[model samples]
Target: MTAPLWGAVPLQADEWRFGLWAPSAADVALRLDGTLHPMTRGPDGAWQVSCPARANLPYMFRVDGTDYPDPASRLQVDGPEGPSLTVDPSQFDWGSHWQGRPFEEAVIFELHIGTFTTEGTFEAATHRLADLAAMGVTVIELMPVSQFSGARGWGYDGVLIRAPQPDYGSPDAMRTFVRTAQELGMAVLLDLVMNHFGPFGNLLPAYVPEMFSDRATPWGAAIDFARPQVQAFFHEAAMGWLHDYRLDGFRFDAVHQIRDGRDQKVMRDLARDLRASAPDRPLHLICEDERNLPSLRENGYDAEWNDDWHNALHVALTGEHQGYYSRFANAPFDHLARAMARGQVDEGQPSPEEPRGAPSAHLPWTAFINSNLTHDQVGNRAHGERLISLVGETPARVIHAALLLMPFVPMLFMGEEEGSTAPFHFFCDPPDDDSCEAVRKGRRAELAGIGYEVDGMLDPCGEAAFDVSRPYPAEDADRAAAWRDLTRRLIDLRMAHIVPLLRSGKIGDGTVSRPTARSFDAAWRFEGGTLRVCLALGTPLGAVEGTPIFTMGDLARDAFALHVEITS
Candidate 1:
């Protein structure tokens, strides 16, 4: 593993090497435990200092005059704005050589670490690994755990790219959680935000203004990816996570917002390097791109989050076509039919927003990850309501069944399987009242634009909001049992039937037909067999001959069914 371009690097048990790229700073000094040591500017304009130190020592860089935490801090043991702590990666003893599961066999479970358990710590989450593995989840996708402001926020506001949030646990505890999951036959993928830094606690712009472009993203200043130093900063951050934590992969957040003008895009370079770094490991890289770009999958990415599938399915199931849902509201069933048959619903098609997407039908079905409920779909609402709450259990169950049974990879948000109605709200703990007010105002405007009742919306910056976001099992025991049973059956069937066919990564494209606006039949053919699914939202369709591994609702009315056949 190569040394990172920034942050404090522990060279020996009693010696530390600190490096910072601050082109704008005329002078730089390291404040390691109250003593100031001047950093010498290298030929490349980077400031470097080597000093006697040990692990857990608090340090900060005095750039020109103002002190700032290490931009590539490994452990912000305090909050994001506090001093950085030196950590030795060799401290954690990974007991076994755990190779990850293949992307084709993935049954991803995306969860937020803070709300995963009442304790909201990595050690607490470790205890639940067996339960997830037993549920047949092949991958556990954690939302960003990067150090952000205050005690909480969806990890997207991460200022320190490499540091694990101290609120969750120490860096070693995080490693333990990952290793435990891997031991239980589940690969762990971390959600990474590389597009822009958070609004607060980011001191990079103050010392290294050249790292950012004149343009800005929705979050903050746009990253100047064209610069070699800027590219190295992000590349090293991601690589450190992959190597140090033994993480299986990453889900790059909001890639559509990442605009790299260079001929060799930074994302592509990062993916290539990550896979090369661990050629023996099954490293999967996924993207959350709105453009529906196929090159990402064609290049080095394994798959992209198919929000098109969720949007179309949500509209068809809930009949609520506000905000982004309006694009599919006109003919959601048809859009869904396209999404299942091909890959993207917006494949070079016009939309209410803009002319979105490129041709995606040529891509393999597994290249798209489909889900009924995700953090974005739930938390972005005026009231974070799960699909079970929106259209009732029967309909939600059917949609979930259809999603899992599809040839595409399936992902479930944290509490969907148990029929938990706990609201996954957009909660955060801002550093101060001014930041709190800013969050409140922005959240209100966002909800109001979505045709929601903004006045009754929960305050995002309040502790009450965070409390409500912690998920719990369903209140009704019977309903919860039924939901769990159905989920287990569906995933079992997927593992047994769908997973084998996907192993070759040569899945035949699905053919879908809509008999009525409320019903559809879809099937995909692999080398050895054909997998079929029939779904009806508000009405019944003709049932297939064979008995389905999973069935929900009345087959004569609104229902979902799955059937499979093998050929010599």
Candidate 2:
């Protein structure tokens, strides 16, 4: 048997060299630019080939005389079944210097490009960069833009890791988006799914067997990260965006689903290597794992999505007690209080819900009060209600403002600034019967226990879902102007004061020293030059005893205006 390193090849300029560990193949040809170039079989059953003539050419492998696509193909013209194209990613001239902002100073805005604008193209989304910059947003957290089956998708189903979706404009258009955002001083954080491939049009299995494990996940069998060559494959994939695409950072999707039993998993080693490769650029690694806090912190990731904070804040403000909200409904204000103060909620004590019990100690966390209104939450719902619909407009606005002012890094979804009434439905395009049926069944199954009929939720693989998720056009200029004003003000406030307070650790233990409430009615008073207070007027319990829980008590006597809202 060949050693694990036998199939390893270094990345070189212009020419692409691939080594395949297919021991049983009689012949393997490297298909480059529509021509088949026969590969040389080396010792240890490794098939090796290099094409110096085929610079910037799209290619795949033909194994055992049968045409098979590259499992790690960077660019594809269409879906997995469509023609693959060679892309020269280095052609784009990047203008911005590779200076990255520290995590503490970053104000992130998470958006799905397809739903961010009506046009749903990279060029179309470019028009909104000024809006993001004006909102004091330093980083734009783009949902996965990789190529997947069909024209429209949430991007989690992506197979071609390097190529952006063709429907969202071309690879050049993607470079334009990144370069434009960079020019506007916004770092791009890409949401990358490394756990499992989508069910439709995944061509990885054609070139490599046992690439996916028998171990199951919510999506499907997890990718085999423990395998020898697989580690190098993922490492290259991670570095490709940084080295080739110039992406600032990555947000790992469902990292908990990556099942690896080895002593040193691929993620840890990749983290070490990534840190080494680009020491100057902030290699921000964020994960969507709910298992435990310490494991993620110790795993070398920079940050993790805080779903607990979302759940707690959603239940507190919206009073929606269905599905997983059951565990978080009775969550005390202390939870939110401590989260803002200490940065983590589940610092100690066994988690009543998780099978793995509780976190041993407090870990730094990013708190999200309104992550529930995201594409996943809204699209997953049977009725697909926006946050404004679930909780009234006033409450939603108050909660949003509160979240923005919190110590942890806050993320806002598209159209959230002015309470966009349209629902962000799950959407896809050019769907077949099986793809459509699977989407329908899967969405329904997800919302089965949410006390709503599942048949109505928009099918992600259907045309209607894509149509429904389109952003409202800028027809109402006045409303759009008002939204810009509000967002700018909030962001300016955060940048001017909130960041400094949090950095100094001035807001200790997040205590509301004034009025307490049973349901929604709440008020708090604070001392010191800068006071932090929380008052909920439209809580379920009823109106608060006193209006405007005065922080900086002398404000009552001054000409300062107090902003009041019912955060029910």
Q: Which candidate is the best by lDDT?
A: 1
Residue 31 miss distance in model 1 (angstroms): 1.7
Worst 10 residues of 1 by lDDT: 559-568
- lDDT (0 to 1) per candidate: 0.85, 0.65
Which RMSD does model 2 reach against the true structure? 5.1
Best by TM-score: 1
RMSD per candidate (Å) reads 1.8, 5.1
Score every model by TM-score: 0.96, 0.86
The true-versus-predicted C-alpha distance at residue 192 of model 1, in Å, is 0.6
Clashes of 1: 0
lDDT digits (tens) for residues 1-568 of candidate 2: 2222222233465455666656567888877677888888776456777666433456667887676555556666566655556555666888757687767667778888887887888898999898788778888889998778777888988877666777788777877888888888888888988887777777667656667777777767677887756666667777777776677888888777776686446777777777788887776777776664556557677777776667677676667778877766665555555444554566545657554324522443332222535667776667667877777655665566656655557777777766676777777653578767776776677678576676656666666777767656454678667766766777777676655554443322333332334222222222222434343533332222334322211222322112322121
- Give one digit per residue, the lDDT tens place, for model 1 in 251-335: 9998877777753378888889999999998898999998888988988999999999999988987889898898889888888
